[model samples]
Target chain A: MDKKGNPQIDLSQSVDFLVFWGLKTDVKAFCNQNRREKTVQLCNLSRTEKTMIRVNNLIKNYKKVEALAGVDIHVKPGEIFAYLGPNGAGKTTTIRILTGLTQASSGSCCINGFNIEKEVRQAKQQYGLVPQAINLDQELTVQENLIIHGWLYRMKSSEISSRIDALLDYVELLEKKKSQVKTLSGGMKRRLMVARALLHGPKVLFLDEPTVGLDPAIRRKIWALIKKIQTGGTTIFLTTHYIEEAEFLADRVAFLDQGRVVALDSPERLMESLGAWAIDRLVEDGMETVYFKTRNDAERFNTLKSEQYTLRRVNLEDAFLDLTGKKVK
Target chain B: MIHGIIAIYFREMLILRRRLTRQIPSWSISPFLYLTAFSYAVGHGVEIEGHTYMEFLIPGLIAMSSMTQAFAIASEINIARFYWHIFEEFQASPISKVSYVGGEVLAGMTRAMLSILVIMALGFLFGVRLNYGLAFFIALLLNSFVFASLAVALAMVVKSHADQSMLNSFIITPMAFLGGTFFPIDRLPSWAGAFLNLLPLTHASKAIRAACLNQPVSIFSYVLLFAIGVLFFSVAVRCVEKAKD
Candidate 1:
């Protein structure tokens, strides 16, 4: 119970109602103050918007193997939450469940106040997914991909046309709109994917390894686009094995290992909790890492090391390795 | 739900339009060769069931073309599943299983219809003509529906394109030749005719030939075809549900 005579709500169970009411209130206030005509009300944006993505005790069993063993997650509205794990660590499985592409063996999840199991259509309408694979229609033009996605969401033809142009411009692929997706460079295809996912203006955008195969320069470009999308108030749920990706773009990162979350916190907080500096030393088995609270302490440890070593700032990868005793990538 | 079906069908139509140039020649050439070789070389001046052999073969060819074209959807569905992964896109969307299967079945029907038109043109060039009436078209529609639904079901189960081709060789090829498409099944041994009678294409050919030659068309064959189509459609929907999970 609270001061307003409202019962105390467990955030995990009532996240949907909170998001709906908060968003409803926000929408009403924005419409009143600005009186914008073109602004489409994707949801009742003014009532209550809080946690945009919530997963509770989600379990997925594949025959004899348990792919996801009772995973739990909560992403706040407009927050960039990164899910970090290695291959076959249930990252893609979790994304598949959230996007309605696969069923969980147990537990429940909700997206933007809509239960994934009971209210599939409503839940799907709340989020747009950029899959790990380049699943765009390769035979279709860049513009056609976006148009088809918009049509699937049941947007009007005129709205689809205008939104395609705007999204293409946003991703800097306006010049290549007429080109077939197969002809575009890898980076361009990735940009087009980001554009396609945003065409319907979904409240939550799931990016599953959005920059996995791209080079350093292109990965940075995608990171910038991700930040841009976040600034527009769309909650971004990103999954990646790239440790640097989480450190660079995530407002909070969850470290997952063997289908279970080992740690969850902001990248800085995670690293700070370990140490301020990290030293990597070459050993017979593999590289071993040691962390220190200060540069002076790292230097003192360096004096005691006989093998080759490199001193650097502590990163999310170190925090992950320390927690799980395994490499993220 | 309907909008999702429309979206899938519209994309297929676009792809078909783009590949029409390369596709039309192949679609026409096979039937043209069949007409020239089988009708001219074998038929000559023969008659069967009070009609010339060419008249008899034309309707059979229409039935066969419709069946093969409808079943051709299996290959396309395989490509979408394994190579392009378009099925994943549909699974991720708000589209229902019914809409996905319905849209794909309709696309198969469209392809079957186009192939029938091509076969008819070739039949005309070979100096063979028959009454193209509502009943004839209706029989063709039912036949295409049966095979298209079967294709949708088979595609979900087949593991690869090689498996699809194997099915084509073992099932479809044998049915096309032995199901009274090119020759009279009655002329064969009674045992062979009894076995071929179990095939859907055999009923399709018999019903279509009756409609084209203005004979007494059997309503039972139409009912049978409709029943088989509905059954296969339900099976396809079930397969899609399983595959999506």
Candidate 2:
């Protein structure tokens, strides 16, 4: 209560009200007048919590087939968000829309607060993409490819040369800088794609199946590279069908089925919500799965089962199958 | 936008440099065969427009070579689009559609000029020389611009390599032979001359021939070529936008 018979509401207590009322102009002055510490904390919180990528009801249609039936996502800065789906589940379509390679039928999207439709150039400048296919210029050497990409982004020659060297060293392809892209192996080509994407220092990296066809050993190497990239405070939006890859790399996982997100949560939380263990029974018709809350319960059920059954710990794939009634791959 | 276009242009130049040896021989062989066989054998006793047969054939060969070289961009664009997916890289970047069309069109024009220079060198070997003036170069440039713009527009619409080859065989090959390259279109039947006049290459060949002979070149031909180039350039930008979308 103040002298004027009005309630003295603290700005810290109603941060949302301040934001909703468009009080950003007077925030600094109001904070300096009263509750300076609280206001500073709130301002810092808002700054740190800024969303890097935002999508609202994004939808795409190809004639009759609804490729993406309205997807909504918000990714924070410095977060690795994995988009998991089967083939033709709109994973690539959503990525294409985000990267501005294709236009959406409706809805809106933004990267680093720039609208993709209205502020297209600025939005594109905020992110880099590594497509599913090997889209490298086969006639050019690895160094030439990076140089051209840098030039496309309007980078200075001195900056491009230094950045190319750093990126090649980071991807462990420094020795192959002069080799033509066609001569590189599949894994090397994939690494080169990653290096090329990072050369411009984009705020967000969109990787469409970065390790799609690589063997397990090379896949692990790429996973390590992805983690290293995230450590540099760049947001990563990764699309892959490998459940284990999502579970191992993502801060949060989104499971899309038939152009809609069926489940989205942290991998541990999603797996834990289903059960701690699962039993796979080889039935007459097909393989049936049963989930149990504890290992002892799973073992008990396994012994009582007459048919062949194996008990194992619940993983992201189990959670996906349980949610969508289909496998990730 | 300019930087992105320069990047594309530089890449094409690098590829051209690497394939220059193979390209030079192929581009020179056709003109050599045309000059040695047509001018020396069939036209040894024939003269046209107060010039020797070899002198008349030189400017026509220049026009044909320029048209073919400029239109050759369609094959490169098709390869980039279908096999390498290089256009996707540009589409995903911040480059404008105009920049992409401009860069590719310029590359095509460069190829045309180089091929013209090669044909001119071969003309020297045959002891056939003509007026190499500002008007001759301007006509060649305008001619290249028209075909290169058309090539960019066609490249956007073509689906496969076979489609590109079909266009080369059916459209380009006919224009090269019948558009006054080997003979004068005025000597043909009235209906055939009218039909050939509709093709831009006919005007290109006439303007190039008149300029090379130091005769009065028609202002209408240059205007027509410029208009056609502008029309096709606009169409190419639109097609690029559609393809990206």
Candidate 3:
């Protein structure tokens, strides 16, 4: 529909969009009618303003290997949600599912209300993923990375140019704009990965281990950029084994363990459930006492040690160990 | 499908552009040296089927170039996946398996065509004449595309990149050699002639050579090779799709 609400688009052109997205004729017609009704009611709103990514029980197998058993996750419009799991725990497999790179054994998934298998183009239009590996063309310069990525997404020339400039500046790579990817440092390449992923201004950005191998300072820098994007209302789905990365960046974190959602909540809430304290025994001269309490109570317990023996502080590290713990039983 | 093709094309071309400088000296130039050494040094000015050895060698060289690189596309991509950790990147991108096949086919064809052009130019420079004219170029292009499709498909379906290398060495080498590469196939054993007919390269090179040598072209077999190429290409696409699953 045009500005005057005259329903200016021809049915044929709309039909083509539906075909490109792989929607069946009936489903296409249904979506078209729904969109028409919604447009009349909410004419001034942006599309992709609702849920960005949704996955239900996605499973994948490789010969005898079941990489992803069954995974279910949903990401709302504008939050940086971290998908955390140990190595080989299906984090990459889930990202592969959401991105439509591989087929799921059985499941339903979508991005921004567009079913991924049926409407891949529309689903793709919702997000970009910056992989853990550098993945940039070592032969192409930084400029070419943005240009080709933009071209892949079918962005216009002017928009591509503007986005490249803005992205380079955003990632603080403005000076290395013409430099080849091989010439960039580890941190610079990682930053370029983010820039490439954002070329089309996707509503949701998925980062797979965004800071996996980077030094602490570089990791902090990438996390800071993720924060800025999440602030700007771009939903971010990131997978990282780095607990600190998830704890600092994710608004909500799902701790995936052995292909199950062992825990899912805000990092603070998950930590709080661990009670922020530990019980330990202090024995001297063949006598001992054990105590369990919060950090404040632990502080009072610490006073007992200062007056008599020894004391220790309860922090997030201990709390994380308590829940989804890794030590021997 | 078009977007997927475009994305795959970009991805493969970008990767090739980065890797070409390193790959060319080994893959493209080294093979040229082997041809020069074999046809010029060893043949020693002998007439092959009433033509100069070099003239006899050009078509085979062109076909060999296509055959070698076309199949190597799969091995190279698979190797990139495991050795370079690059597969994770493509896996995370929204580029589908179809796009992956599309891009690889485009890139492999481009590389195959580049090799064909280089070999042809060298044959021309060396004064090797087959008198087939522009028909030769068209045949060469078709051969290039067919071999490239087969190669990309081979790369996707094969379990191991190392096995791919073996296919190139064990499978590709003998076929290119015995399929009228250095001399005419008619002078060879009868079993070899029957065997060559079964190979895709034999048809691609035969159509190209027959047209270039100005013999009556086998229009049926030319179309047949093309149809077979399309089938192989589809097989390759299906393999890639299944690989994703």
Candidate 4:
């Protein structure tokens, strides 16, 4: 203990002391005011080592209907994690619980080590959510929307203004800053949502159906923008119905079905686990897919050899279908 | 928390500012029609409780206008919830429900205050100047508080914009006309007076009319309106919390 009866630690060993004693709060209080710089560095270092978004055994029920049974997810820092699920698969429910839009019936969600239910403000500050719907204020200008987002995050006006300028430019929406959101095109509105979400500089971004209903070109633009955002070291937790979008972007993907994660792996590994090639055969009821280790092996498969089949490379969707027995919608 | 409240209020004010050109005139027409029609056409040469009809009607208009304008916030909230989805954005933000309700209630009070000003201006044009003192403004503020809180509570309870309209038609419209806005409550039958007195607006109209006419205002009216405001405000916060759930 120090002269004030506070815990004393050598300055050089503060980080180690934190690890050894597991007394982050006490150390934070000790490092308050005088060792501010050290405190920030220590906290940031600790956060970097922790999972960016952690949800454990999350469940949700609407009356008798179980929306999410027992979902578990751990998103790593600076990686693009995709949540792929069919309709009614509880993908949105997981995102909702993590983002604090709704509560999980049971279990816990932590964003950058802050529990969403208990440490709401800190957890909320750690992440920005781009919801599936376009929730931007259509009556306001693009700059105004970003400004409001910043204000909601408790950012000062000067900081909000500077971030708005930088984010609008980053989103390629600088020219549309003065334009009302209602007048913007669909892609521009989507881009504005991205700018608004990034205004507070959150460590994690939750993107729910980020590229839905967009044309191929606009979708590619958003994908590139998402990639650029990830390169800036912001962890991305994405839920998308488009399976190829997951294949093209995700560092790792989780396939959810009936409120449970059926498969979780990197895209290449998930496809490789099934095989390198997939044969699409028209069955009596519907189409069926068969996986093979090689194109030659797929050619030699005796079951679909007599039937008409198209040889194609395996994709993430085929793997999802194989694992969940349900198409990723 | 204060910053979050300011941010939400700032957003509402921004939208209001953008629509002022349309809103100002829309807010003006009702008062203008009442002042012209009732003060001249209907109540000319009519004096109730030793005051000209115009003098008596001005404060009633103030109370009614403030109530209606404050309650108008429900429509804006409905639009945000139903069409803009801005409420979802707020839900995803770090703002507390108390701050959200506080901000919305403040916006509602502001709209009420503006409508009161318009009515005061209209009364000035019609040569119906009243006391316009501290008590008058306080009563107006309390009345606005009651209705604004009610608006926020009802806004959250209503499932759709159409239900909001139905609330206005069923609750606000009847209260505006029957809650001693255009006439004296005591002049009616005792049963009717007793029933109307049960409405919060009756006390608001009584307190405001007494203050504006420079008559002795009852402390009960002030106390009761304040109590009702607090009750409605609590309900609003609770409803917002439930809506978030």
Candidate 5:
């Protein structure tokens, strides 16, 4: 009633949807849902607040160059958000800040409703971190690795065993439990990292270049595995220079350039936003991508094409190149 | 912390078992060579400290070899970590700093103890008379533990494996020589012999040799050495965790 003859809403009144619904919901059902979410969230990093990981005016200097200039990002929960940038774009630096490995010179971050600086232990508990480095213990057996993970979270021995059995079954490593990690294949080790992250049933996971060194076939396997995990309910925060990777796995993609978030949106939304751009797609030895947005635009490009290639719609890679204005560095 | 240490200890021990067969010949054979050169060659003419020159040298060589091997294990493992990127996997785990340092120290201790055992076995073959008893085992274990902790601490401080090898010519080499590992401490200048007591290994070797030659126990020296070792153990863990950070 303050103006324009309309009812004035109280700006101070805010609803706690999570707590309200959580209490009203059946505890057993809620627990089961949480259990289901644990797998999905094992690779995700999100916050209860609107922003999952908030990095404010962050600065990180590595010798002569500043890795991260002042950066700001807003991510919501349950999104397969890919953080993309060229080499040295601070994508990993931003990720490191979110995950709490490298401390920010002057900034703050939060994860799953807790401040990352003040409540780091709690923040860590909420998200599993798969670092760029291979983090599995080589001497420990597969089962031993999982047990050690559970111990990190201080999980009860009985609880850890049950979860280990279930996780080993899920990861297709039930029989490899007794085998030492050093003897496992690279793909197997990658899968073990996933299993280790899931031991404590976290709500989010931070996957930092998950498939960096794998072959295409193994990459696809890992991708499919990530997809399978996501569909079960965990949100993911991924950082990679691979355009096609972001395209294939991410729900929403954010392009980071020069320590700034250049672009952020769903793959479809991004393609639609860049309305006038046309992509000429011809793989190195095959017809991989040949797509256009406008017929007039396609006509201009037709002068350069031959009949040996197929033409289709432009993809995430095109949107990425257009938005970031740089390819993988 | 204890759990992580034990986990690392047993895990390393498991790997050690795989490498032990090769290690035995490598470490044990050198002592026999030393025994013939010092025990038989020198012993035919010289006698000092109420025993043959060979007897005095045996205990010292045992201590020197064990200390050198202990430090080398620490340095080698860390250097190997950098080359293999094994530390990255360690960093990725949720294991605390205590466990990480514990693993290195435990591995070094294992090697040192193995060397002591090898030295003990070689004592008989080389005609070095050393009595075997429960006291000897305790002395050996404690001596190795002190050397291992010091070795790990040194390893954590050294920037590179190459640097560590260089330090053996300066830091560790002098320490071994001055630590009374190669000669009777009493035979040195009185002030220098007292200075030798400052090293944990010196007291360890003394306690070990005292038990060996049926000499009277030096309780003050034993407690002081254990105290020094405990201090280094704490400090070693600190240095390792700091480097990791």
Candidate 6:
């Protein structure tokens, strides 16, 4: 016991305690107190013991073309992992395979240790999917759609009713519950989809371009909602073509290009590996981006005085362009 | 599996309830028109096999209407697939193939039962009453089961609404007119009668007419309808499994 009547937890046991309780704020506070070793220990524990999604050497082949070739990814619990790519770059294909909508040609995947192909029902119970298409039944009211989802998940009637109320409120769609899906605006429909996906309290949530067609204002609201969901301890696997969305939302980002992952890291680290600042020059054919170590270095580049160029912070798009020599659409 | 089937059936019932105001009227229109036209035009004093022509035609309409209404579920399935994309949601869900087929088949059967009731009411208004017994319902149930299972199977295989219409023309329309619905197969040539006897609907119409007329219902016809229903149900389940792939 400590002098102030609080229990003095041993260093070795505190890691397990914090992890078991999943008190992110307390862990962050402890990590801030110069506990580098403990922080590393906690991270390694999470990486090894708490992988929410694990994919190893996944490949998908169509009749003539390979959509995914030897892809691997490991997503940590309660973190937002983004799969960024251009059009037809296998982002949706990977999501489809992981969600069990498509089968991989070779490799294996597991959700929370349940092999998707072998233990399909158990694996499916571990995650919820918010697909890109607005596939809600337009003839049914928003509340009815959610009720059907709850029943499919096999929840009790009472629990389904309670969760419907809570989730509709969580997504800020409580007022629109009685309205038909076709009557909803695009943003409202997207929000309702999120609510329906979360109806069963899944351990993992798959968001396939959740904010794809929404305006910037609504997109920002969705971003906030995603962050809130993460805080509630749901692991998020997001796939999108929007570079800035990944930069803003993902804790770790994987850049997929032509059925291969070109780069994988935190968005900041991926950008920082090249440089901190970028200078874009209007070349003969298109924009050519040049990176520099510092803003002053970017400003004082000799070509800046002679050519029409602009300086800005390095972004994920710049990093992707650097790695693959192509832009993410 | 049971819960999944109930969930799917519940969704279909909700849609049916909401559209009932329009659907009930539509269900009544055909039987009403058919009864009025047949009874007035050719049935003033006609008798076939010791019964009025309306008595003969009522059971035929019952059989034919039940077959057509039950098979109409295919259009609903196609609309949910192509327009609403609700089938994708079912695919991603943890529900088994049998549960989905069961729920859809049940919905189809419900539509058939409702149409049969409408036809019976129309028959009553025409002053033609037959034995509404357990055998009559059993035959109608088997008939609905056959067509509903067939509907689910065909819905899975068709690529577009146009293809579904073509299937209706090729499979259902011909069966409705030629499967002993309007006239007894004995009235045709022996070769034509043998060909029509091969249809499941022929047995369905025969058994249904025999039961309503209080004649000894043929147990062979009952067994044949049940076997055809099971075969079509197996095919429907297989098609749904293939769809997932």
- lDDT tens digits, residue span A117-215, model 4: 766888899998999989999999998888888889999999998888898899999998999999999999988898888889899999999999999
Docking class of 1: acceptable
lDDT for every model? 0.86, 0.88, 0.72, 0.88, 0.70, 0.87
Kindly list the per-residue Cα lDDT of model 6 for residues B125-221, writing each as its tens digit.
8789899899999999999999999999999989888899999999999999999887889999999999999999999999999999989999999
Clashing pairs in 2: none
Q: Which stretches of candidate 4 lie over 4 Å from their true place?
A: A1-49, A300-307
lDDT minimum window of 10 residues, candidate 1 chain A:
A38-47
Listed models, DockQ each: 0.28, 0.29, 0.23, 0.33, 0.07, 0.25
True contacts kept of 1: 0.62
Candidate 3: stretches off by over 4 Å: A1-49, A59-70, A276-296, A303-320, A327-329, B1-7, B10-45, B85-99
TM for chain B in all models? Answer: 0.97, 0.98, 0.85, 0.98, 0.88, 0.98
Off by over 4 Å in 2: A1-49
Q: What lDDT would candidate 5 get against the real structure?
A: 0.70
Error of 5 at B112 (Å): 2.3
Question: Model 4 chain A — which ten-residue stretch has the worst lDDT?
Answer: A33-42
Ranking by DockQ: 4, 2, 1, 6, 3, 5
TM-score of model 1 vs. true structure: 0.90
lDDT of 2 by residue, A1-329 (tens): 89999889775547644543445547655654464344234334434668788777788988789999989888889999999999999999999999988878776677887766666788789999999998899988999999989988899999999999999999999999999999999999999999999999999999999999999999999999999999999999999999889989999999998999888899999999989999999988999999999999988887787888778889999988888889988
| Angstrom error at residue B41, model 3 | 4.9
Colliding pairs, model 5:
A1-A8, A40-A234, A41-A234, A43-A205, A44-A204, A44-A205, A44-A235, A281-A289, A290-A312
Q: How accurate is candidate 2 locally (lDDT)?
A: 0.88
Candidate 5 lDDT by residue in tens digits, A1-329: 97688888643232223332333335545654564354224324434345555555677776567788776666666677899888888887877677666666555566766555555567777778776767666766888777766765657789989999998888888899999899998888888888888778876778889988988999898899888778877778888888788889998888788777777888788878655445445667744433456867776776676544434566666676676656664
What is the DockQ (computed on Cα atoms) for candidate 2? 0.29
All candidates in order of lDDT, best leading:
2, 4, 6, 1, 3, 5
lDDT score at residue B5, model 5, on the 0-100 scale: 67
- lDDT score, residue A291, model 1? 90
